[model samples]
Target chain A: MSTATFPEETRARLEVDAKEIIGRYPRQRSALLPLLHLVQSEEGFVSAKGIAFCADQLGLTTAEVTAVATFYTMYKRRPTGDFHVGVCTNTLCAVMGGDEIFAALKDHLGVGNDETTEDGRVSLEHIECNAACDFAPVVMVNWEFFDNQTPESAKRLVDDLRLGRDVAPTRGPDRLCTWKEASRVLAGFSDGRGAEGTQAGEPSLTGLRLARERGWTAPDPDRLPVGDDPEGGAA
Target chain B: MSTGTTLTPVLSDNWDRPESFTLEGYRATGGYGALRTALGMEPDALVDLVKASGLRGRGGAGFPTGMKWGFLPKDNPNPRYLVVNADESEPGTCKDIPLLLANPHALVEGVAIASYAIRSSQAFIYVRGEVLHVIRRVRHAVEEAYAAGLLGKDVLGSGFDLDVVVHAGAGAYICGEETALLDSLEGYRGQPRLKPPFPAVAGLYASPTVVNNVESIASVPSIVANGAEWFTAMGTEKSAGFGFFSLSGHVTRPGQYEAPLGITLRELLDMAGGIRAGHRLKFWTPGGSSTPIFTDEHLDTPLDFESVGAAGSMLGTRALQIFDETTCVVRAAGRWIQFYAHESCGKCTPCREGNFWMVQVLDRIEHGEGTEADLDKLLDICDNLLGRSFCALGDGAASPVMSSIKYFRQEYIDHVERGGCPFDHAKSTVWGGTA
Candidate 1:
């Protein structure tokens, strides 16, 4: 339970965004997940004020909001660094040097898992799979991928962030946003970077390149076998 | 490297282009043609075509897609919904996130077509919240579809209306299970509900709903565009159509290989340039971490649903997590069990408690402080956990443990005798050296 509350103007502005999000779902309660993200965007974490605002907006109790927020790993109860650097330590990533990257990062940054640096520039954590396994030993800064990472590369990434140097993810946006801005995007508000980076990464296109190289393509649908169920009613 | 089965890229065809995620890029490749063709026909006819195609769900469970759509009662009093499960959090299951990032329009178009077929007026794409870029790509695709008159309000002048909402899920792997997904979408803690009435009967606001994997839904557009025969012609008789075979870890060229379903791992490994230099294949997972791990001996087994099942593993999401001999089986299984223990949702006792204890036993074994009786104790714990949980998470937790021990019990014994992990951890790393 947090005693802090958002300023009056801040609460008023957040209300507008909350209402817009509430309208997206059929029922207002269904907007809780995004609403949590919206509040996270406002305060960098879901504070007591954020929970109270959500409870009021959705007509739910604070306990209900807290339960939902706590269930998710993304919503932080305390302040987070501007850039949250997560190293994927799942099975595949671990065997492929994710453990090394994570250990090196902790030592380099002088912080343990889920702890922020003294300057509040970066927070370190060992994340589960973020689904970019082909680019194993992956790192994520503010939910943007830094694929195919090694301990050395991961170190340079955090140092750049700490020094306020420009750092871009392996895929997606040309520029990286702070943690709060990323949360806003997750809450369904676009930062207009939706079409920023290349649509596909190199590994993602391996199959397409192989198919092209081998001159393999799906059979033409127009030349399909006849005398069968036209509507495919084999069920 | 020449195998009888060659690659057939449909969903992943345009991924190489820089603009593959954009509407302009997708339209150039005849992307929305399926939705246009599907919109003109009766909904029942569209469902029939899907049934004829024999397209199974690309999510871990190999349920027939058309059969899942047909389960809705004819006279549903409430609105029907199509919830796309884009939460690809399974360790080593990495296809859906990349698919969304590369070609989100495919899923958007498929959502339009499937929602119309199921008579759903509203649909939602529940993506995992961790991938911000993916969520943006998919949301942009939905926005583009709506702006192009393909999604909202009498779509393409066919008098059928649909609304697509892209919902980002807060982190929970259990939400990948469909029922838990609906609960999460409804703003509740993402825990699985008892399944007397499946999602088809009563789901998502207590109405008829069809939950589908992102890949299964994305594959719909091609099925509509190409016809059932075109799909059925590619793969085996039962496991029809092409799917993404995601190869990751310890391979010469790891990536997504979209090929016909029945292609074998032996053929795939050859195409992927075989294991890394100076390394031979050891153990691997045929699917994601949830499925049983397979050794090099099973490489020739057909990578289809039935054949993989016959070989005692599953073609789960076609996520082939390859590990070479340099990797430690005990360490791999221990890491995967920690994931399950961390993600077990605590809604059920067996999964909540069983995973906790299994982690302790495996950690002890991995550290070379266990007797041989501890291995049996681990198996005994797995027996209690398997088939007893409310969801598949427990069964999945048991998979790597039982399979790794079965294949590498001698290795476990070696760890005990050597008093620690035998393989040099630094050797398995990317740089292959200690800092």
Candidate 2:
């Protein structure tokens, strides 16, 4: 019987990660999270095969890997859209009418929680808290945090996202720090505010004067580099 | 009654003048001096001191801040990480955002000190994707820390290196859970991670990580500046420390009330000038919406973990979302259930589907269409979903529904029995404006 073998490159990436589990842990399961990251990064998603791969790499049973993956929020067992939209439906944001925001996105994009858009452009997941209580009623599109979001804003956002419109410029995203100045605006409102997604004119997005001053990145959406013509320089 | 403390400062306690956020201002306020002092101490000793302090997580879960730091494996090649959960999205949990806005440096310094203790050269303060302004402020603080040599390589020449990166979530509530947060930080969709190997064991970048709430980390400076005994002296034993109780929703002075942890809600209400004029207490959340709901009956319950827990609720995130008699219990529960429903990251069935179903039932009841069976259905679903989810969100989402129904079933019954809300009809439309 003939058996398939992993390519050398794939084999190298698949090498044992005992380093993550070594030394005085309760068990081999301690390395589950790291193993999951490795498997997910290599496979782009955690399939049964990926779980097996993690199990093999970590010297653990497949059941253990599956259990760890099943345990955490970060591990995605299924395929998701390129741009994931996590709508906050917790205390602060929910009171502010995040319901309308979630509904508008669902209606506008034709996707509910965990279901990707028909075109696979976005996946909408209703999430508990994104931690920006000050900016209740917020949605995370891709990696950038858009605050004080309204249904109308969500509509514009979802629409622009579908069309692949330009992303608004943001500040300090490069540095990886929380924008403290936005709290001033967040403080302007109170809790139990906004019942459904956001007020008709709310989810006030732009923050602090400095944020506006610094330009932001829209995260270029070019799927393949081959299509664009370098009219000005490439030739 | 008032320290007359003044609302001038938002968060920059030790750095901004009133602790201003400016670089020069931070320098003047004895900012990096603590980092300098900390650098001279053996890293493990700092960890030990923190553990001795018995400081619990302040963001919400109240994990022992010091004990959490001690959990990092001392001998490991893996890069340990420190993540500050600045996604203060809890209802009535407004302290962190405001504190970060007013005092980003406090968190930054705390991060730096914490990084040094855990020997983690890399740290990330995971902010909520929203609150762009606070994100910017934290970035500025990080920039300041880097410039002052408090962050970046060999911080203060302690031979310890740390990089404080501020990664914002794509704005999902579940990301606040340390594991879900680690997932979000790794650039995945945000959802909660089941515990057992809490972030202390494996976290950011899948390395040994210390995930702390913003308040938990921010309190470090004070803890370090003073002593554990000083901190413990204030709050009751087993719940030792100070905390920021956010007073909102019809409070006379709706803001953060920083006091010893054991202080009762009655005292906090007094500090906040009591509920808004002519408004008496109805029901409220002791922490964010997750912990069980409390009412005027619980006003005197000591706002400590043990006391609150003993009273059948958690002192989670101390976000007092107070309501008054004017508010409708059914309507309020419906609104809160709507939040849990919408935010239920659906990885598990109970939260994702359960919250949605609960909201539907509550909506019918709120709209005077619900039957008594709906309430039973709500309870039944909650029983199945609570503690059955992949993360605590399921439990949190069911908290208000279960607690509200327990305390105010008649209010729900009244809605269904009367065929209309007995409370203000004016407010019913307010909640329904979403459609």
Considering every candidate listed, which one attains the maximal DockQ? 1
Question: Considering every candidate listed, which one attains the maximal lDDT?
Answer: 1
Over the stretch B325-392, how does candidate 2's per-residue lDDT look in tens digits? Answer: 66677777777777766566778987788888888888889889989999889899999997898888
lDDT of each candidate versus the true structure = 0.91, 0.65
Q: Where is the poorest 10-residue window by lDDT in model 1 chain B?
A: B426-435
Superposed by TM-score, candidate 1 places the C-alpha of residue B324 at a distance from the truth, in angstroms, of 0.4
Model 2 compared with the native: what TM-score?
0.67
Interface RMSD of 2: 17.8
Model 1 residue B336 lDDT? Answer: 93
Provide the TM-score for each candidate, comma-separated.
0.97, 0.67
- Per residue, candidate 2 scores C-alpha lDDT tens digits across A1-235 of 1123345676565564334322213234434454554555454456776677666666666775666567444456776565667786654455455666888889988777877887766778776654444454568764345666777787887677667765442211332111112221121211221111111111111111111233321111233134333231432
TM-score of chain A of each: 0.94, 0.62
